[model samples]
Target: MEFSSNIKKLVMLVNVTNSPTESEAAEDAHQAMLNISIPQTLKYSGVRTQSGTDIECSANETILCDLGNPFKSDQKASLIIIFETSGITLFTEQITSQLQLSTISEQTDLLPVPVTLNVKNTVLTMFSLEKQVMDTSFSGSVIGESAMNSTRDVGSPLEFVFRVQVLGEPLGDLGRLVIDFEWPFAVSNGKWLLYLTEIVIRGQSESHCVPPGKIVNYLNLTLSKEGTKRNKREVESVYPHAEASVTVLTTRKVPQFLDCWRQTALCQSFSCPLSNMSTQVEVRVRARLWNSTLLEDYAKALRVEVKGKATLRLLTDKPAIKMENHTREFTVNVDPVLGEEKPYEVPLWIIIVAAVAGILLLGIISLILWKCGFFRRASRREMYEAKSQKAEIKIQPSETERLTEEF
Candidate 1:
């Protein structure tokens, strides 16, 4: 008997002790009935026959094989059974299975105990998802948007817009989106004063908007900058318009945790089973800078650098057909407070101090130059004349030198 991983085949051999002659074989034909039971994870396909004959059997019922006149006394006979996997097998490790056989006799002269045979699978059983042909890809990006004024300010409406797309065919049945935020969104004390006011989901075929009343109150807001709105608008312009889409959000409240610096995650089932169709998810989160203290560290401009990242996961019933971790980062400068309107003017004391310092520096530089004879430098014409006089004196003898020589 042989059973292997690549080919799910079971073979059983039986020996006949009593055999009749060929003339009497027509009156008594060897017949056997076998029971087949399999795990839920595996589905039973039809058995393979040697004569190429089709056998009809129900999917849910146990398979019974009728071997007609194949066995002979003192002759070897083989029975083959085949099985196939059902939906999916999540286990990748090796598994052991045993095939046991027993016999029963109704005659009083025969033994009451049934004969038994055990077959064990000794070879390594390898299970992998490589055989499942699938094509899927995931990508996403996050941005900040301002609703009230162009500038970010306290109590002003802000938005963290996230756009995720699952491209290619044969997508997953479920999806998960996790966003990690910086200090502006959450604090060290685990206190979330910033409220997530709204959540809007936009797809190629459908769109949904959830107001503040429906959302949970304990969510936080990430820091955003003036330039984020421009980026958000650009994403919207290129958003794909379609008649069919996947619904990834099924719950009203988004889950929040402190581990990811007040991370937020949304997990939902697809409206339909993932198939050879492209799906897009656009989530617009309305927020506010209710925690004014988050911006206290910045001076002059109410600027704060906010950072966030998103991870998208695609999951299906089959663990083998899975998408890896797809993560993206977005960082922007945000001004939580209103921008300073008045023109920046120099302070009176600062101007006086600057003027005094400048005068002192100039005086020191002038003194140094004067000591090095910079102030006593002669004109170009005077320098030329001095050079000529020196040349003449060198060429001729001085009067005093001539008198000394005569003496």
Candidate 2:
């Protein structure tokens, strides 16, 4: 709807028609006015001529104007009427007022016939409408980050946290909040490197007076992967626990083959009439990592670069809230520890075979030495007997020689 000051200031174009004699035309022109019947609800301000000159006026009283002299030939004039009131019109309400030419001049036969006019139907809806606005701020980061540096082990869990805060009471209706995430690594040879697993949402209002479950009544959260909705049943089941002390959780395995970029999005909407209160919403997204990824591994650490953006929109036809997209970029240092090595051990059968071989070689060497007399020793009794026998034989031979000499 359009707004203008003319809505309060009324303008009328007046015309007079009569065929008067030369004597009447020669007479002096006189001042005139139109009797106005305005509604009692209206508080009339002063009036003005077409040239913006002030004219005395009263509430529900006469509107003094300068219509051209009726005693002369046909002529025209304009009257500017200004008024004010406190009443406001709704969608289709209107106001009406009646205006009639003064009877004093009409009784004196100044004009040929009576002139009557009415103010056109006027509606002041544009003046009553107020622009809807809300002040908000958005931010996102890795949960355990320190100076923009984060760490995640290979095949371990990673989390991303996002928050939105309202500085004042929201005059406009709340719409969906969209957060888009693009991972640093992608699918490797049709295998998933990393994918979203679960999403958690928490809220607080009234300067943190309201807790997670109570604020669930005002929130509607959803999860999406590659532009497709996920966890419909899980998200719906949380509504029954609006008053419970539970946070909203939606769990789903992001489809790996659907997209290579691992693009995921989360959306949240809210109800209205949260009066004179501050609202804060937090979102935590958890993902699983695989050993194989396209990220660069340096010095036993895989450094992955991640980026994401968050946007908040109002469910209004004409929005006055000005919000900027929340953006974040960070690096994750992943340490994939390698396994330890063990010592080699010999088998029991090999030990037994080596022992048997050594025993057999010793036995064979002893038998060969005995056969070659290297280990044999003669008896000492046999050597002494042989020496005694030799001495007896020498004495017996000398006796035989003595017998021969006696003969």
Residue 189 alpha-carbon offset, candidate 1, angstroms: 7.6
User: Model 2 segments beyond 4 Å from truth?
Assistant: 1-32, 51-71, 89-92, 103-264, 275-407
Model 2, span 45-147: residue lDDT tens = 6555553433344543544444433323333334555556443221212355566554334335433333333222221111000111111111111121122
Q: Which stretches of candidate 1 lie over 4 Å from their true place?
A: 1-29, 33-44, 49-64, 68-184, 189-195, 201-228, 231-283, 288-295, 298-347, 356-407
TM-score of 2: 0.29
User: Alpha-carbon error at 180 in model 1, in Å?
Assistant: 12
State each model's C-alpha RMSD to the native: 15.9, 21.6
Superposed Cα RMSD, model 2: 21.6
